[model samples]
Target: MSKKKNKVRPLPQTVGINVPGVETHAHLDMEDFKEDLPEVMARAKECGIAKIGNVFLGPQAYETNRSLFDAYPEVFFLLGVHPNDADQYTDADTQAMRNAFKSDSRLKALGEIGLDFYWDRVPADVQEKVFRTQLELADELDVPVVIHSRDAHEKTLEVLEDYGWSGKPLLWHCFGSDVATAKRILDNGWYLSIPGPVTYKKNEEAQEAVKFIPAERMVFETDCPFLTPEPWRGKRNEPAYVAFTAAKVAELKGMDVNELWAICAKNAYDFFGL
Candidate 1:
């Protein structure tokens, strides 16, 4: 068998049209971008990304690493305790998140929160408790919700419905599920944030779901520092890579990349209330 050498793929800036776009989710605060974050931000800007939502795992991360993106005015914030960290949620953390939201105008949504049966770091009951608590907090704050369900979609949907989140400002992040799942999300009046994996040929379900999802209800996210889109797969993902995801979605929907890019950006801006 021959060894498969790395291919020299085109940079993200070369993948999509130079039209304004938005990266609905990112984690630029992670150690991956610590060394060359400035260069990454520059490339994202050059690739025509207008705004980027930087998600903080919890109140502490928001307080500690939120400032890292202050210099980039186009970056917004999303804060929540992840399901994997269910045991870590406390009343104090809740208070801290409340305080942060009250003080920071950049915090746009309560996000990356929900079920994650894929990882057994936390018990199901504990994860449910934490998820419900954050959902309650989101309602109290009247903020939008960004979900992070993994292999627990049915449970996540049931919980959202139970919380009366239908027709509310909600986003299903990294939605690489099937048409039925996409329909379920849309039926609940929630937005679907298509991630980089949708560009992969193996992710045919998501690709087909994209065709079924209305452009008005669709948005693009790199989920960066993760889910690096092809042409750049196996590389560290950054906000710039969102352009490639948006480009691929446009191609799948038979729309112009520039137009689709702008539409998704607009949808994201409206969803986040930017």
Candidate 2:
């Protein structure tokens, strides 16, 4: 008789808490979960994650993972060229993004795009050009935009203002800016997607931002497999852990966790039309 082989499955590192909400930003298509993606999605659902916006960083990423929208009905996508990869963006890439947006109803927005001075991989001039190009694409398509600004908040807002972004829907994803910046974002009528950083004790700015931003204009995200919240910091993040961010923000706002979740979920739905 041939000996039988036993296969052992790995346990999910982060268990999701049962708190229904929407994770406004994540990258489920990334290679980080190549082996355990099914389990990750299941855990997110079990944790009451009703919907997720899976952002694609570039044309290649979008082309590779475009099937995820049909595979998971709860998962929508945001296609754009990230500022870090701005140098590599081409006319062909822009056309591909346009085609994808046109063909897929699940393509909710154009984003994870903006300025990132911290990396400095692409020249600031090139980043701005790519940023403006994508913004124009979003404007032409009449879709919302998700922005990623790091160490370039002033420039980011300047570009948005220059583009006459007053009437469009804009989301500042993973907002870690100061109170004044938050107020400015609010003044521009842009939504803010809070992330796991709010759960950290040292993230006073995030906490303060949450306090000032009204409930209607606020949303939550995981930005996983990154920015794992407190108690799971330094570990891989996933959609399920977005609850921690909600709980922390709720506490800061002196509201019940579920109430905050519902508000943010509705805000996400309204903003992304999910």
Per-residue lDDT of model 2, residues 1-274, tens digit only: 9888855423323333455578999998888988888888988887778898899888788888767556688988888888999999899988998989999898899998999999889999999999999999998899999999999999999999989997579999999878999999999999999999898898898788789999889999999999998767788998888877877888899988778788888998899887
Per residue, candidate 1 scores C-alpha lDDT tens digits across 1-274 of 9999978788877875677778989999999999999999899899998889999998888888987987999999999999999898999988998888888899899988999999889999999999999999999999999999999999999999998999999999999999999999999999999999998989888899999999999888988889988888998889888888888898899999999988888998898888
TM-score of each: 0.97, 0.92
Model 1, runs deviating above 4 Å? 1-6
Once fitted onto the true fold, the runs of candidate 2 whose alpha carbons sit more than 4 angstroms away are 1-19
lDDT of each: 0.91, 0.87
What is the Cα-based lDDT of residue 34 in candidate 2?
84
